[model samples]
Target: MDFYLLLWLCPLYIVGTIVYRLFLHPLSGFPGPKLAAVTHLYEFYFNLVQDGMFIWEVERMHAQYGPVVRITPHELHIKDAHFYDEIYAPASRKREKYSGFVAHFGTPSSMVTTIQHEHHRLRRAPLNSFFSKRSVVQLEPVIRENIGKLADRLAAEIQKDEGVIRLDAAFTALTMDVITHYSYGKSYRYLDEPDFKLAWKDAVLAASANGAMLRHFPAMLAVSKSMPHWLLKKLDPQAAVLLEIQHMVRSQSVESLQRLQAKKEDNEKTNTAKTTNNDANDNNDDEQAKSIFDALNNPSMLPPEERTLDRLQDEGQILLAAGSETTAKTLAVISLHLLRSPAVLARLREELISVMPTPISTASWVELEALPYLTAIINEGLRLSYGVTTRLPRVAPTEDLQYKEWIIPRGTPVSETSYFVQMDPTIFPNPDSFDPDRWIQAAARGERLDRFIVSFTKGSRQCLGINLAYAELYLTVAHIFRRFELELFETDVDDVRLVRDRFFGAPRDGSKGVRAIVRGETLL
Candidate 1:
């Protein structure tokens, strides 16, 4: 009996030791806490519960481990800017995105979802026209008009309260309006009419909250994915929220398509009239120019068999989701920082004033783009806030890629957390402090700023709406400051806190939300 028991115990001990050596023992040479290599669930729990400490944790690991640190058995976290090139370079092997963070909503993969290089190329081809420089320039008027409406609305509020206004709701409204316009055209005015349906608002809020839960608990998502859809919905409220969001997007997309068809019909009629009069040559110039919608609708522009209406509509929703929430949150954070730093705010206002005079009806994009201080402030806000703090995990395309001394095997999920990159003390002295001047000085010196900038991810998979984002931020912030001085009313600047979300950070604790008292109502 004793000999038999010993035989069983010997194999069990060997298995345990092998597991340790494969994970924790070898990773000990690199420097992360033992628990991190042994199991990633602990770190995941810390990230979920520790109120924005995962960034600091990753920074500590990078400081100790040089550049590459194993965060889990199958994962490596990288910090070196040089590695960014290797990781994102087109020539280098590509990696699949971590399954936990992927936006899998039952629809086929879009550009943002495609993991394979070939698939990504195919996915991005059709959508490229919508984000091209020319496309952005053409859409500038739409963005400017929306910004003007936002300013006018805020000014009306300021007039009501003696030049004081709460900017939280106003900014949210403005971004939603701008993104929706670009996504579905001007037919759907969610922002113009003041009354946003409470049910729709609740659905959006619920979807955001549930999304956070799903990211934190990947196992739950996996389990739900395996379960029957009807049963899953009954068991999990998050599933229901996800379904509701998809439904909302689909319904809105259908309406947008109908509107697009109507517009096409009107254009055809106008063209026919011009041709009848033999004025076709002159009227060709008068033809309504192609909008982003027109570009998406063009079959010749997209690859064969990929230009289906459903695919285009799905892409449109993706743009709306990606553009709207992130832009609004970034704007809110900037407003909070500006209100807190009165001197910074004053300097930015001065710059805006120099660029545009009082009684400004319309300022050209060229004029807005020329404002150095304005661009610096926006860039700085994005850096400090680093609103999307989560790791953008990409999978290794092939086995045996060398990261430092360690060979990161294929099928491993590798990522660098932007939160850590943004907070590097060497890169930005006193990284926590909100200093727009850092960007200004960097620009003046002509130092390579791209190393420090990853507000949008780098390389081929970079944010498609980057130009649009810049245009929107420039116009919106410039116009707002040109007319009104923002002052923090209820919330203390230091009291500002981030409400952690799955994909991004938002304001926490019903922080009466960036209430800015507007000063100097009339521009003139």
Candidate 2:
């Protein structure tokens, strides 16, 4: 009798909540699926069980219900193109990242995951200079060297494997090595691996997966963060990898700290006057290991709370992964499109030859970036790949958002994704094609197509790795195309199709990477 009574009461409670949400909720008038309005499970099934289908579903919802849709009981998604600038404006104090949106990395402490605008600014201030245009130009030799190493590895692979090499693995190795070396002043050198089998890349993806998992089941973050690795491996081995990385970063931080302290102590011992140390240290940068560790640990203006070993470790892991993975993904996009369309590839190669004209013995990164056709190819790649496949939610905590007719109340979550804007048929005709000419033509006609490509997003909270990613993409693409003549080896469009939006937009399965043969000799 008691069980029967409980069952009746549970139905009554669910129906009551649904009815209230339908009519009385603040967002009740907004158009969306009835199931979504009632509960979050509608989104959970799509995002989790379906592997990030929620973003796609939002597009579908917009198609059915117009531009604005109630994505969740508490969040609203806007699909209007005209409203993008207003939403992502440089002056908008509404730059607070949605807590629910960022819970994935389980890194609320990270600058990428920080929710408060002022706090995010404070956290991001120290990282800005490291990725500046001047900084990237200064580091061009390091980037070019990494790209050259990959070419050497690729040439060796081509020789061994009948000129068939897996470009996905090769590009991943190059990016992982470059970012790690740039950030920590040393790299694991995944490019040096026989066949470039980077086990650490698997760890990086697993960490991203863990972050996505944290978004839906947030309590799992606490458990995942605190659980012992030995025990974790028994149930879920992938998650244990993330823990190992954290531990590894912690050890590195301690070592770096000790090294810096020893240097300071040695300086003090050698001289009675401390005034000469700063001048001497500036003149002799022999012990200067320029890395994220050095930059972050030694910031004089950052708050004390943001300057812990754990904070540094969390940030280092985030920077290394974010910097490497996204750039690699974009390069893969370029490789896929270029392979599919031989004409576009031919035009690009011709342009490259016209500029260098001497088999590309040596080319400046800045000069390579300035070439008209090369810039066009890079732009098209960025647009086609769409940096992140999903939208990043921004909440205006203190003020209402106005979009033409509708006045969205304060604290409402709003978002726009590159996949939607970059692929908009009205803006980009034949949106699916890999046409470098689109960018070139648009430039000639004076179209503001540049604004449409939100690969790095817009406004203040934009990617900190923008300059670095550009430098890598520009150098790597120029280096590869100039040095090697590649043909698709057992590779097709389906292999590199948009299968999942996890971590970032990923290619379809059964794709053994961007496999190709090298038919030309190294020119740079």
Candidate 3:
């Protein structure tokens, strides 16, 4: 009798839920596929089964249903660029992150994954100064040192048969080393690897590939996360790379904490000795060893709960993953287009030459930033790379959002993808063309095209590593292009196309990404 009743109740409950969602739900009036309104499996089919095609489905929804469409039962996606500010709002506005979207990350304690408005703010407060422009400018030596290593590698490659190289992998190696060095005061030294540690890049991509599936089935992610190392390796070799990365970061965090503790004890002893000796010269002026962990461990900077080893590990994971891949993709994009367009390449090379008089000449971040043509090319690359390549949903817990005449109720999840904004035909005419001149033309006409470039996103939760990314872009591009003459090798526009959205933009699966040959070294 119990079994029979349970079977009957399950169907009835499911049917009743779908019916209520279609006709009686708060978002029922909003236009979208009835199937999407009824269940998230509609999203699952596209993102997981169709391989990250949900973003395209959303675009089609906006095309057919209008700019504002309910993408999920509880979430609305607004395609209009004008409405972007209201959704991603400034620090003054109280915008919470949607937990449904954030839960997939498996990093609940990290600043990026924090769901509440106030809690995210608390987590992010101490990190601002570290990623600031001033800090990045100070860290320019680190950026150049890595870029110089890359240049040396490229220079050496010129001696090979075709001097063929995978710019995508090489760029990833460069960025990975810089970020790891920044995080732990020691780099993974990916740039030193012969194959540029392709497995590590695969691991990053694999983690992103799992995100869409995890979003739909968070319980599976939770279970997988808790599984022992041996089981995880058996289950999925690529996914296991994520665990290895986590363990490495956690170990670094523990070491940093221990070092901080030892430093405190040493300082206390020094003070005691000074008091006993009554020595005026004993005013110790020891500078602390610096790493992101050291800053995070400071008790005065963050509260006790926020400074824990667990919190530090979670933060480290987000920092390293966030800091690496996206910037590398942008560099790869810029390199592809530059190699394809001789005029654009010539113009940029001329500009770089003016600033850097010789092939091995060095320039400051400020100096590189001032080159107008170079800046324009970077802006174009960012527009195309589309940063996260997914619709980042934000929730307003306290106030209703106004989109045209529609009233989006408080606590409703709303999103505007950077893809739509970056490639809007009205804003960027010939949006598919890799034309840096669009930026230059906009500037001459006194139009501020920068507002449409949301690759770094906008408002309170914008990318924390923007300054570091810019520094890397400016330094890497200026150094590489100025020093080496690279040509496209078995690569074309399709090699850098935004084919799939694996959290970040991706080219087709089997595609060899953005390969180029070192023609020769350039001299002034």
Candidate 4:
């Protein structure tokens, strides 16, 4: 009797919850599939079981319903390109990140994953000056050094019969080296690897691949992070790589803290003896701060609680992942399109030659950015890559969000994805084609096509690494095109096409990624 009563109660409770969500929930008035309103399992089927196909399902939802549709039972998605700014609002408008959405990456303490808008600003304030455009321009040598190394790697491939290299892995290695060097005052030197440390890139992608499934079970992220290496390897080889990364970052953070403490103690002991010594010590400390880790650990920059080892490790992981993967992916896309279109490639090479002259000649980022054709090519690449493919949900904490007739209640989670905006058929005609002239023509008519490029997003929570990413794109694109002649090797449009929406965009499963043969050096 007791068992039968318990079983009947469970079914009744589930039915009650479903009926309440479909009719009694605040978001019930909004448009979307009734099944979606019933339970999150509707989303689970598409994203988790179907492997990141929910993005297309959301598009279908918009076509049947209007632009504003309840995506999850608790969240709303807006498909209007024009409404992007309002959702991802400016600094004045207080917007917080939704906790459930943010759990995808599982980096709670990192500025990128910080839930509150105010706290994010507090954390971001000290690092702002370091990532500024002028600061990145100052750091150009670090970028060029890595680019030169990459060029050498490709040049070596020229000697082999196969000569075919995977651009995605190669570019990932380049960006990884640069970001690691910047962050730790030393690089992982992935570019130095024979196969470009392909496993590390796979590890990063594996983390992203788990994002859709992890959203519903965020605790698994913590479980994976804490699991013993032997057990983790049994679960997933990539998870072991992920664990290795976590351990590396944690060790680095500990070393940084120890160095900071030692410096402080040494300065204290020396302070009583000489004024000149104090000034010299200050200069030395400033030099030490060149490493982003040093800056983050500095007491002047962040509070004690914020600079804890665990938090710092989280920050390091986020930096490495964000700085490397997105830029590398964009570079791969740009390279693919350039190799595919000989005419565009020739035009770009011609423009680059006017500045680069010899194959080995060098040009500054500022100079490369000034070229109209090169800039158009870059803008087109950014459009096609579409930055983070996942929907970034932002919440209006203080006031209601107005979208046409509907009033989004305060504290509701709302989001817009760049993939949809950048590829909107109404805004960009022939959205699928790799045409750079669209940007050129749009610019000739005084149109602001750049406004549509929201790859880095906008407003207060925009990616802090934007300057770093742009600098990498400009230098890498300019260097490769001007120095080497590459041809598509068993690669086509499908190689770069985004079929899955992980945190980053993913091409179809089993795709070899963009590959090319390094035909001898470019000769003007």
| Candidate achieving higher lDDT, 1 or 4 | 4
- List residue ranges in candidate 2 displaced over 4 A: 1-16, 161-163, 270-289, 522-524
Model 2 has an lDDT value of 0.77
- Superposed Cα deviation of residue 352, candidate 1 (Å): 2.1
- Compared with the true structure, all predictions reach lDDT values of 0.65, 0.77, 0.86, 0.88
Model 1 agreement with the true structure over 401-456: per-residue lDDT tens digits: 67767777666677876766777788888987888888889888997664767777
> Compared with the true structure, what per-residue lDDT tens digits does model 2 show for residues 1-524?
99999999999998899999999987898889988998989888887788777778888899999888998887888876667776776735557888888877755567888888888878877677778899889888888788878877766655655657777777888888887777777776888887665566667776775656677787875787678777888876656877777777778778878877787688666554546556654544344437767767664647678988778887877887788777887788799788788788778777777556655455777888888788888888888778777678788788888876777888778888778888888888998887888888988998868888888888877888988888888888877877676778888766666667665766665557677887666443
TM-score of each: 0.80, 0.91, 0.95, 0.95
TM-score of 1: 0.80
Q: List candidate 4 stretches off by more than 4 Å.
A: 1-9, 236-239, 272-288
Give the lDDT of residue 274 in candidate 3: 75
Order of the predicted models by lDDT, top scorer first: 4, 3, 2, 1
